[model samples]
Target: METITFHSYRGGVGKTVLSVNTAVQLALLGKKVCLVDFDLRAPSHQSLFISSTFSMSPTAKSFTGFLVGDHEPQSVINSTDKENFYCVFSDIEIFQQKESKVRTKLTQHGEGRILAKLFEFVRYCNTQKFDFLIFDCMPGVTYRSLDALIVSDKIMVVTRPVKSEISGLRLVISECYSKLEGAEIFSIMNQVENIKDLVHPPNPLDVNFAKVNVLGITKCLEESSVPIPLLHSFPRVPFVTERIYVLDEKNHPFTVEIETFCNKLLQK
Candidate 1:
């Protein structure tokens, strides 16, 4: 089974959106896929799945619990309504308990043991004959995020077309991504400017500025210390809130973009 991790230098870049929809899309294609919410710092998959047209088996065994040896690997996996699609969610409550043993195990020490638990989960998935194991990781370079990166076969670096992200992305690449030896690194340039989506009469200045933003981000990736190949670019799709568009609105531009991205990812 191929393991892929969706990571970002910063939050609010739609990493979870891409990872969640991609997993569902793959399941729709008749693949046995499991998506793990490794973003324990601020877990959202539980809520996202709860709100979507999908249902996760009610379980108290969270990924964090499994990592801390409070639960077994098999127990943490919550089956979903979608066939061949399963998910392991992280418990934010556990993380929020500043003095909680689970939180201490994850944050203070036992780095090696925590990584082993992650590997154990992957092995369990492999034994279950899963086609893909995707991790919706927390943004930035934390020990947990790095463990996910180290265990992944491919790292999907999600970035946005913003000037502020340019320098931050560079630092992440230099300090974190560059040191990773085995995993193949690729980037997804998300929230890109698409003139076609502009208003009835687009302003000239707005159009020019959009072009510059896209160009700046492109150059940032190409010129980074370790150039990360651009896998796909997703146009900014305005949404009031997060939902699984692939299931709720299959024809949505965002869902269509996700489908196209999944197709390209399968090729790799």
Candidate 2:
């Protein structure tokens, strides 16, 4: 099975939204896809899945449980109503509790063990004949994020067109992504200014501002230490909150973009 990780230098770049939609879109295409929420610090997948129309079976264990040797890989995997779609949610409470042993297992001097557990989960997915295993990883360069990067076959670095993000992306590339080996790296320029599709006040000044920002982000990616090809660009859909758009509104602009991205990703 091919393992893909969706990561970002910072939060609020729509990484989780893209990863969840991509996993479901692949499942809709009859591919067995398993998504794991590896964002332990601020887990969001559990709430997204619970609120969505998607159907998920009761999970006996979370990803944190598996990492801490409290559960087996299969037990942590929760099947969804959509055939070929499965998920492993992260427990946020474990990360929030200061004295939580699960948090200690992930944060302390157990990175090697954590990585081994991640690989063990991957082996289980392979044995299950899954077509793809997707990881919605934590943002930035943490030990846990490194584990996700090392175990991935392809890394999707999600970034946005903002000054802060540009500088942070450069730091992540120089310090983390450039050091990684044996994985195909790609960038997803998300929330890009879609001037052609702008449907708001239609201010010329706003348009010009957006153009400059997009160029800045593009240039930052182009000048990275390691060569990371541009995989896809997702336009900013106004007023569309993060949801399972692909399943909720297949014809929506955001859904269309996601479908297009997934189709392109399958080719790689």
* Best model number under lDDT: 2
For model 1, the run of ten residues with the poorest summed lDDT: 51-60
RMSD of 1: 1.6
Instruction: For candidate 2, write residues 27-139 as lDDT tens digits.
Output: 99999999999999998888888888887756558889889998999898888889889998988878888986767888875749999999999999999999999999999
- By summed lDDT, the worst window of 10 consecutive residues in model 2 runs over 193-202
lDDT scores for all predictions?
Answer: 0.88, 0.89
Off by over 4 Å in 2: 196-203
Q: Model 1, 191-225: lDDT tens per residue?
A: 88777766687888878877777788788888877
**Could you tell me every candidate's TM-score relative to the true structure?**
0.95, 0.95
Global Cα lDDT for candidate 1: 0.88
List candidate 1 stretches off by more than 4 Å. 109-111, 200-203
RMSD for all candidates, in order, please: 1.6, 1.5
